[model samples]
Target: MAARDYGQYSGITRAMELVGERWALLIVRDLLVGPRRYGELGAGLPRIPSNILAARLKELQAAGIIRRAPRSRVIVYELTPYGRELEPVVLALGAWGFKALDEPREEQIITPDSMTMDLRTAFRPLVAAGLPATAYAARFGVAELLIRVEGGELDVSRGDGEADLAFAAGPDIRRLISGQLAPERAISTGVVEVLRGRGELLTRFASTFHIAA
Candidate 1:
């Protein structure tokens, strides 16, 4: 599929022309983390129709934003170097959008990529620095995400392993990050389950990332 031509000389318009299609930027968002097979990408974007997803992928590939490569004898899609340069743009948009997250509505669904990217946008290195290095495995039923804070750096990845804490993603987790729900309440209410690691780690972990008010 061909991208729309905005016919505007502005760089912003040209950039938008490439990504303005529905699910285009979102596809890029999911690929920002790492290479993903078609199935993996579909998992992250459950709402997008398979046909639309395929079309968007074709458009992006043609535009040089992504490329297909063989990984472990299987094909996977990943962003090109030029595409990876959109990191700052994506993070900036994520940070700006946080203040609008008053409360998650019934219709609002949080995907693993959205959750992981939000953490990347919300991470406070100074706050993580004051706390001991920690790792967390967050499960969202559809997928599990690994978040690690070490030496004042934050890393978010797919898959799961041993961690300082683990919890199911839900309203309570959302509220906690937004500073609406307290850790104590989350535990007492059983909204978050501890699968491994010390309970105390949750407090420090909560402090490290916050959705903008």
Candidate 2:
């Protein structure tokens, strides 16, 4: 069968027009976290050329996925409420990619803030399973973390502890979650450290959440 041109159908053509080219997804990913200036976006994604970045930004704006915010007579790109809805898609795609990659030899260091966010998803199950009769939690990397529950409300805090499960990363949050950080060497010297829960209580809840492999 003769193959049709990708630039033909309106829907297919439009999808291609928006995200078909390289760097488009990266642009979307950058915006997923929060609003960022052009320079910040460019710096975060070094692989994209300036000219291409400008063009793609324009296309995203035209597609109503992003918009400019005014600040001291300057404009910065930010997601529109409609565009902000894509956060789930961006995160889900990243999660899927992480699982598809090879397992690393090193412990993926999950940071304090990122750990809080990760727990937002993973910790929910623990709460649903049954909140401990007392304050139940995990500690890692000289950091103490507690996600306490009572009366259907959630409380989270971090401090000092003989961390039963310590998590640290050799790379940034984006790299780890995206699975670009190599597994074999990443865990070799322990640049990124992960000290999992020790006792049986922590062990039972270990599968509660993960930063993939």
lDDT winner? 1
In order, candidate lDDTs are 0.82, 0.56
Which 10 consecutive residues of model 1 have the lowest summed lDDT? 167-176
Quote the positional error of residue 164 for candidate 2 in Å.
Answer: 11
lDDT tens digits by residue: candidate 2, 121-175: 3433444356443233444443356655444454556663443334454334233
Give the TM-score of each candidate.
Answer: 0.88, 0.55
User: For candidate 1, lDDT tens digit of each residue in 1-213?
Assistant: 456887779989878877789988888988887889999999888888999999999988988999999999999999999989888898888888776766567777777788788888878898888888888998865658899999889998878988879877564476777777788777777777777777767677679987746
Model 2 gets an lDDT of 0.56
Q: By how many angstroms RMSD does model 2 differ from the true structure?
A: 8.3
| Residue ranges of candidate 2 with Cα displaced over 4 Å | 1-5, 10-13, 72-74, 103-167, 171-208, 211-213
